[model samples]
Every structure is written in C-alpha cells, then in structure tokens.
Target: MGDNNSAQYVGIDEVPSPRAVGINKVSLLPLVFLIFYEVSGGPFGVEDSVKAAGPLLALLGFLVFPFIWSVPEALITAEMGTMFPENGGYVVWVSSALGPYWGFQQGWMKWLSGVIDNALYPVLFLDYLKSGIPDLADGFPRIAAVLVLTAVLTYMNYRGMTIVGWVAVLLGVFSILPFVVMGLVSIPKLEPSRWMVVDLHDVDWNLYLNTLFWNLNYWDSISTLAGEVHNPKKTLPKALLYALIMVVLGYFLPLLAGTGAVPLQRDLWSDGYFSDIAKILGGVWLRWWVQAAAAMSNMGMFVAEMSSDSFQLLGMAERGMLPEFFAKRSRYGTPLVGILFSASGVLLLSWMSFQEIVAAENFLYCFGMILEFIAFIQLRMKHPAASRPYKIPLGTAGSILMCIPPTALICVVLALSSFKVFVVSMIAVIIGLVLQPCLKHIEKKRYMKFSTSSDLPDIDHITNEGTLLG
Candidate 1:
C-alpha cells in the first residue's frame, strides 16, 4: 500500500457528473443479455467440462457449483453495484471498504483477467469456422482474421453500450436457439443412463474445475457497467436474477442433450464438440447452425467483456486512481482511451493458446476476487448504516459466511495453476504494484490531472486518519 498520509483527496467539485456524458443508458432486457454474454454466452465454451469429468460430473458441476459460487458473487454484486452505481463497479466497492491503493490493484487484476478472457473469443470464432474456411486453420490468414475480428468488434463497442446490449440480445437468441432445437430432438434419443456415467479415478480434475469455474464466473463483471444501466439499483439486481437462470439453463440443458444423445466418447469431447453433437442429433444443417451460433456467441462475449474492461479504466480515472486521459469519453459517450487500451491489450495477448489463456485468467481473477470478498465483508461490518438500495439479506456474520465457500473455491483455483501461469500472473501483479506508485509519483509531480467524481455516492468515507469519511 502507498503512504496513507501522502494520499491526495480530490473534492467532488472538480469532476463532472456521469449523466452529463450523453451515453444511452442500458435497460433491463439488454442488461440481462449483456450479463448473459459476459458470464456464459450460451454454453459455447462449456464442452470441456463434459470432456474432462464425464457427463455425470460435468452435469452435476453445472448443477451444484452455481449455488456455491455464482449465486454468492452475483448477490454481492447486486447489492454493492447499486450502492455505488458508478462505472468503477467493484473497484469502487473495494476502495470504499479498503483504500484507493487496493482498489487500483483490484481494477488492474480484473482488467487483465477480462482481457485475457477476451482473447479466446476471436480464436474460438475462427475455430468454429476453420472446417469450412480451411485456410484459417493457420498461416497469415488466421492471424489476420483474429486482428480483423478484434477491430470490427472493438468498433461495435466504440459505437456505444446500448448497441452492444441489443447486439448481445440478438446474438444470444441465435446462439441458444440451435441448442434448444438440439435438446428437443435429442429427447427421443437421450439415454437416461448417460447422465450418470462417471469414472472418478480417471477425471482430469484441472480441466474439469477450470471449465466449470470459467463458464460460471464473471457474474461480477457486469458490476463495472452499473453506471451504464438504467435505474441501476432495481435493474441491476433483476438483471442478475434473470441472467443467472438463463446462464445455468444454457449450460445444463446443452450438456444433458449432447452427452446423452451421442455415444459416450469422452476423448471426442473438446472445444467445438457441440456442433458435432448437433450434427449427430439433428444433421448437417443443425451442425452448421450451431457453428454459426457459436461464432456469434464469441463475438458477443468479446464486446461485452471489452465494454466492462474499458469502462473499468474510465471508472478508475474518474475516481482519481488513473491518469485523466483514461477518463476521456467520445461523442458516443463511450470511453475512447480506455477502449483503445483494452483493445490493444486484447490484440497483444491474442496469440496465447486457449487453455493457457483460461489458466492465466482464472489465476488473476481469483486474486481480484479475494480482495472483493474481503472488501465485501469489511464494508458490511464497517458501514452497516450506509445507504444500500439493494442490500444482500445478510448480517455481517452472514455475509462473511456467504463468502467462505467461494473463497475456498478461489484458493483451489489458485493452487491448481501451472508454474508458467503462476509466474506470468505474478509478473502482472508486480506491475500493478509498481505502476500504482509510479502513477502517484506522476500526480505529485503535476504531470497529470486526477479527481473524484462529485456525482458518485460515498459507500464509505475513508479518510487519511483511517476513519470513514463523512
């Protein structure tokens, strides 16, 4: 942490209100789909859960893991998101409970995880299509395709959040519809015993846990966009409710249909296996549709994630945790600088393999979440009387209890990381540690402007004297 005495507090008068930015606010339906795309994207990438752990454990993981992990994270998000209701999202939550120094670290780790998570999409998009466009399997065509895809989707994000939300709605329908048809048709062929088949001794625990965690995680990502949603206090919670049900069904139903309809060949299960399952159950036409839907789903996830990450940078800048340039917005009311920064990071890291990306991201994500959980319990204890438009129905001890299981899961994820991933993620963490002080030094030298937004609600008042601000 930085020197608490040296920390500069910017009064509210110096910054502009978020409403004055002229961006279109997201409504309930769009927000739900955005969260959908952010969190699951209709099970497009959940095939590995079945592959690693078998149909039974994969299905059971989807069934039971959400209650342990997703629900708790989403609940905390709904409560804290509304209480702060700014672009900074979880960063604001951590800052209020901890300090500006830790808040910046949370933002850095989450933003990196988000970008690493996003790099998988363009590659996945191509993976779904490579069978048809054989040239894209490798060579200049594949690299160029990833770059072009990133640019096009980045532009969609640059256009605005409302557009991104509606696009998610459309992409979501197209993506899930084929699976719906597959499930319907497969009902006649699904073997009841297939869902119960599992070999515990043979399970690839690492892959199984990673796939389950990756798909169900990111529910809190939407919190970063709280300022972009319409009537965030009410809309945010309702959207999380609707999105949670949609995301779980999106995974469980497809896993049930695919595993049961087809013969059990665990070796055949990998990324893009769902389309093959569609082919067997519904024929070539269904396979093609599933592939197209999977591709579109990747695109949806890319835009949704890019939005979260870019807005997070903007939120940090607004809170005086980042340089003023990151706070700049375009005429469309989107964060131009932050978008460029996030998009650039996506391109730079796009070459990493899918599993590598997943492992690296999960590691960073676990770190950020540890901070978030601690911040959640701390805020509840330290500010019991603070304004909370959508408080979690839990007392201080209850909140801490709610966080325990997920916190344990986080430790499991961290412990499972490979040495390469552990090293890379630690390097990223060190950069955040050093960067914060460098930024503070820059601020002290008068090289940049930074200020807290007047329009933001004070979730807790943390002063230099280590007391809550009035």
Candidate 2:
C-alpha cells in the first residue's frame, strides 16, 4: 500500500534543468469552481438535452445520470487523484497499474479530447455575443475574436493555476447568477406537468446522451492538475463534493425553469436557447444577463480545460514520455511549452463546427475514461491496501459492481457515436500509438532530453509493473 501522508513534490534535480519552483497551489474554493467549470460550466450548453430527448428525459438525465455516472467517476477520481497526487493525474495511476505505454495513451487521448472540447468555448462565447454584435457572426472578425480570446485565456493559464482557479470562481458565480434570477423569476409561470413531456419516438437519443454526457462527464479532468492543488488529499475530495452539488443545481434549476415556463419547442432548444428563455421569462435585461453569463462561462471552461490539458503534457514529460522541453515551466511555474502546444491544437482544431467537435471530443474522451476505469479497478484489486486518501467506501466486489453501470454507459456512448466521429477519433488514437514509439526513438537516440522525477510514488504491484518512467 502506498502511503497517503507523503507530500507531493517533483524531484526535478533528477528530472532536468528549468526546474519548477515556487509552485502556486490551488486551494479549496478555487478548486471547487475549477472542478465546477471542468464538469458543468453552468447549463449554457445543456439546452440540447431538452431539444434532443424532450424535457422529461433531459430533466431525468441531469437528475439520474449523476448517480450512475458522475458520482462513480468523481469517487474514483477523488480516490485515484489523491492516491497519485501529482500533476500527471490519471497518467500516473494508469502507468502504476497498467504500464507507461497505456499511461501515455491515456494522456494523449485525454489531452487531445480536452483541446478539441476547448475549441467550442471561444466560438460559443462569440455566438452568445454575436446577436448584440453581429459583426462577430463570421469572417475575419470571428476568426480574430477566436484568436484573441484563445490567446488571452491561454495567457491567463500561463500566469498560474491559482489565478485560473480564482477566475473560475468569479466566472462561475457570474454565470450561475443570471440563471438563479431566471429560475426565481420563472416560478410564477411554471407548469409542473410540462416537465413530464417526453417524445420517446421522436427523441434524438444520441444528441441527448452526448449533450448530457459532455456536460457532466469531465469530473476526472481536474485530476490532471492535482499537483498544483493545496493539501489535495483534503481539498480534492471536499471540492468535488461542493462542485458536484453546484454543477447539478447549476444544470437543473435553469433547465427546470426554462422548460416549465416556456412553451415546448424542440427545434428551438439549441445551444443559446437559454438566453432566449431568459428573454421570454423575464425581459431584455435578464436575457442580456444570461447571454453575458454564457459568454463568461465559456471563458471559464476554456481556461479550466486549457490548464488541465497543458499540465497533463508536463506530467507526461516528467514521466520521460515526452522531451524534457515539455516539462519546462514559466516563471509562474506553469507549463510553458505544454501551454503553447495545447493552445496551438486549440487554434488548429477550432475550425471544426460545434456539433462535430462535441461528437469527436466525446468519442475520444470516452476512450480515455475507459482506460481510467480499468486503471481504477485494477489498482483496487492489485493494491488492496494502497493508502488511498479518499477511498470509495466499497470492497473489491462492491467496487466492481459500482463501475458496471458507468462502464456500460461508456459503451453506449461509444456505440452511439456518428460514423464520422468514430472515424476521426480512431485516427487520433492511431496518431497517439505511433507518436509514443516515435518519442521513445527520439529519447533513445539522445535527440532530446528526457528524465523521470525520482520523487514520484512507487506502486509495487505483484505483477512487476514494468518501468513507467524512462
């Protein structure tokens, strides 16, 4: 069993130069909002759940899916994340349990999924604002908007995770405030039976599931930045608990208010539909507030997602999976090179249309999560006494049973992916497989520096888990 009491610090003396120092750790409040944005980011993007499956299933999804999927995933994350309380997050867990090869694959798939997922926010931010500023509808202006927004947010990430964490706190409050107002204002117009509406035959199951899954499933993303968290053993678990409640309420209140107050119009319930619901329920002032909140929430999501994606690369590099250049940090102790790489990917992939990006990211994300699930269960079995700071209160059999529903949900999500999404996602996976060996070859030939941190925790399994760090 690994000891939970050991403090987390990268042994960069054994690692290489440009050593990270004066690390800015994320504290409780900020960590909660970071997880909040990582997972829900308010209900700005969840309107499609109602559109696809009607109000009944959408409501039920936000209500029920959390227990089956979110809770289990969050529980596993709190356990595994604290178990390996380093920036490498799940990469470390997979490597310790499965091997470095699969760990790199998890990192690759997740980092790529995160970048692809991030591409949507800047575009959506503009979409919410474009109504008031029609010039942003398309052309050079929109492109430039995307670039500027990406740069500013990326720079904020480069500043430090602590700053990003606080920013998320502010943005989270701003994003949810209007919805709170909308929900309260909407009470007089509520039609309780409207929540019962469901068109089983007409439901677009894929869209509903995808929207629900996309909004709810990124609870594990925060694990990537666990190293920067203050007292993560205590902070991580509590933050997740608060974030889960905030996220569920964030989605449900607005959704309940929107569906019950407004007349049902399946076709009209798209991405920015909540802003319209605000207008209908309240007035132009409330509508504008919702739009502004939506835009800011997108920013919150972008910064939060970028922070995780970039740090995962640094984590991988510290494991000697990538060139040491990736492990370089800015003066603020942020992953400088990794941030550039992630930002570039976000820019390159931003050209993808919204639905296409969502479907593709979701497909790749599901693959990474499947690996994570396997890693979680395998560790519990192999290292039964491993000092998990936040163990899910379940024995080996109970743990397996708990994973069953979410793993089944993952299968359903993968099966439902569009052919185009499946093809594109598979290509991304192939790239990761090929990229791994190519990195090894580069390291073998001394073309680039690569070294593992000695401070990393050891998880000596009975099967002799081969060398994870090069």
Candidate 3:
C-alpha cells in the first residue's frame, strides 16, 4: 500500500491553479454548522446512553469517547483533507495511500454506510412528530410521510451545497437553542449528585457504546465536501476545530442538565425522552420546543449526510473510479445522480426498526473506518514530506499510537454486533469487493464512459514500490 508507483498517479497540489470560477463555495460559519449537523445535530438520540448505562457513564462516554474516536478522526481529516482537498475525502486519502482498487472499496463502503445512516433521519423526524400527529404512527400515512419527507430533503440537497450549508446553520441554531434554554431552566432544579449515579454490572455495553458511537462519529464526512469549501486548506481545519468543541459540548451540557435536574427514571430515557425532561423542567411550551428542535435536527442531519454521500460518489467518479456520468453536476453544481441514488436508499431502508437501523449502519461504518485508519497511517509513513496545508502535530510513531485506541474501539463495536447485523454487513462488504472489478471490466469494454478530470495534477515523479498493506 505504501508503494511508490501509486504515488505517481495524482495529488491535489498538482491540480491547475484557479478552481472553477462560477461555483459558490461554502464559507467558514456555514461549513462549521454543516460539520455540526453531519456529526451531532443536538443530542436528540443521546438519551439512550443514559438508558443503557447510568448517568455517570453516559456523561463520561461523551466526554471520553471523543479522545478515543473523534479527536483522532478529526485530526486525520484536517491533515489529509488539506493534503488532498477534493470531494472524495477519505476515499481520496485511501486511494492515494493504498491503491485505486482499495479507494473504490472505501468509497463504496462509506457511501453505503452513509445511506443507511441517512435512512434513520426521516424515521426519526416522524417519530418526533407522531406524538403531535397520531396518523403518522403507522399504516399508509406513515409510509407516505417517509416518502414526502425524503422527497423534500432530497430536493433541498439537489438545490445546491451553499443552500444546504446555510440551511444547516439555521437548523443547527434552532436545534441547539432549546438545549441552551433547557440548561438555564434546569440550573434551578439541579441536583449535582444525579450526575454521579452508576452501576458497572447493570450496564448494557452494546447500547451504551452504540449510542455514543453513533453520536460522536462522522467527523470525516465533512471532508467529502472539502472541494466545495472556500479556501479549504485554511477553512477545513478551523471549521473542524470549532465544530468539535460545539459537538462535544452539545452532547455533554444537555446531558448534564437533563440528568442533574430530573429524577433518574432510567427506563423512561429512550429516544424522545428529552422532550419529557423539558416538560418537567419548564412546561408544555418547552416540551413542544424540544420536540420541534428534534424534528428540525433530523432534517439537518439528513441533508448534511446526503450531501456527503452524494458528493463522495461524484468525487469517486472524478478520480475515474466510477463511470463519467457519476461526475456530472447539475446546473446548481450538485451531484444529481448521487442524490437520487441516496434518496432512493433512504426510502427503501426506512421500514427498518430503529434499533435495527442503528446497529446495521454502525456495523457497515466500522468497516469503512478501518480502511480509513489504515490509509491515514500508511500515508504518514510513506509520504512524510508531502505538503499538508494542515499537519497534525504528531510524528509517525505518534500517529500510529493515536490510531491504536480508535482501532481497538472499532474492534469492540464490531464484536458487539448481533449475528444478523454481522451477516448483512459482510454481504455489503463482499458486494463492494466484487463491484470494483466489475466496474473496471465495464470501463475497459467501453460499456460506460470513464475519465479522470483534466484539472487534477499528475504525480509520476515519485517512485517507491511494495505490495499492498495487509
């Protein structure tokens, strides 16, 4: 994987000067909120952490898991994203470090995992609304609601990333404001002791870890849009740092307030339980506000995820990993085909139970992330002198050490998966393994047009050789 021959393919620095002129690039504030929605869109689903473990572990998980997972991932993204500064994000990183074949695998796995994750948002949005609109609970109305919601969000993405980025900023502010208010109101009712409750033997490690993993992960998704940001080299790293602080506090402070203020009713701490906590602390008005925030949060997450997933496909296509048609952008500069495919996946997967959706997506995401970590380390070792607009302060040994904790955490998450999720995720992996070769054959046969963008710089000067990394 560290072979020098692959280094000759291309690097972002070699690209021609002056990006496409007419494109409207996302600025810093919008990019921060976009990353915000991509990761934690207000702690809507974090109640499950308290439900699984007690208050203390739940609180600690948000605080601690970032060091284990989020920080490493964010740091890698900052360095490599500036290094590659393209739409493919991690796919570009893996392809550069590993090979085009493995890069294609990265793209497929991450895209599929993203689609499965996106599927959950529409269901979650409706789940929040069903309390007010009982008709959405089941039957024809429920299915229709999924379709309409998916269509609307898909259109928002289709309009363009600039609009989507701005919308995320708006939605993020709305989603988070209630929690800030909740924290203020809860200050009066605060019982500091409630935050300390914990029982090791009583913990459900799977649910607790899954909840934390789902909420804290996805730091790399924003890298998929590095090509869309203005002055990505400077903006990407700054945005990530800001978003990291926002997301960690977003989850932790709300949990601190919710747990400290309310009496511990562990069983009642399921999906939409925060609204209940709001009702207790403030009144029905606060409860309604929280519910509305949750619903909008889901919308923000859907668009942010769809943007990442679709642009990834466009990025892959531009790198000549997929057919040229996938590289075609709409008049609005959105990835039209990628958006359609992602929206369809969401519609098809919306029927899954909430637990099933979370488990299945987490399973697939683990595989994608493993490939990413390998690519990150391999690049650090092989291209130590490569121009990185934003370099992590770690040396080669430190980089490897940084990855070990998250890699171990990935193993734990994979081990905890149910038999059914394991089988399903494996099938998805196998399909990606086969699909890359099939696409290669089609490209050779001229069954579909495949071409790399002419604007990308060629890097045939670098030379080193070895077999792919294990």
Q: After superposition, how far is residue 373 of candidate 2 from its true place, in Å?
A: 1.0
Candidate 1 lDDT by residue in tens digits, 110-131: 9999999999999789888886
Which run of 10 residues does model 3 get worst, by summed lDDT? 461-470
Q: What lDDT is reached at residue 115 by model 1?
A: 93
Q: Show where candidate 1 strays beyond 4 Å.
A: 1-21, 461-470
- Models 1 onward score TM values of 0.94, 0.94, 0.94
Model 2, range 1-470, lDDT digits (tens) per residue? Answer: 12234222221222222344566678999999999989879998888898899999999999999999999999989988877777889888898889999999999999999999999998789878887799998999999999999999999998988789999999998998998899899999999999999879998889988898899989999999888887777889898999999999988888999999999998999878888888899999998999999889999999999999999999988888888888888889999999999999999998888888889999999899889989988987777656566777788899889999988988998999999999999999999999999989988999989998766656773223222221
Q: Report lDDT (CA) for all predictions.
A: 0.87, 0.86, 0.88
Clashing pairs in 1: 461-468, 461-469
Stretches of candidate 2 off by over 4 Å are 1-20, 461-470
Every candidate's CA RMSD: 5.4, 4.1, 4.4
* Per-residue lDDT of candidate 3, residues 1-470 (tens digit): 01121332323454532334587999999999999999989999898999999999999999999999999999888887887788889998888888999999989988998999998898788777787788988999999888998999999999998999999999999999999999999998999999999999999999999999999999999999888989888888889999999999999999999999999999999888898889999999999999999999999999999999999999898999999988888989898999998899988899998788888989888888999999988887776655566777778899899999999999999999999999999999999999999999999999999999877633222212112211
Runs with alpha carbons beyond 4 Å of true place in candidate 3: 1-19, 459-470
Arranged by TM-score, best first: 3, 1, 2
Cα distance off (Å), candidate 1, residue 469:
16
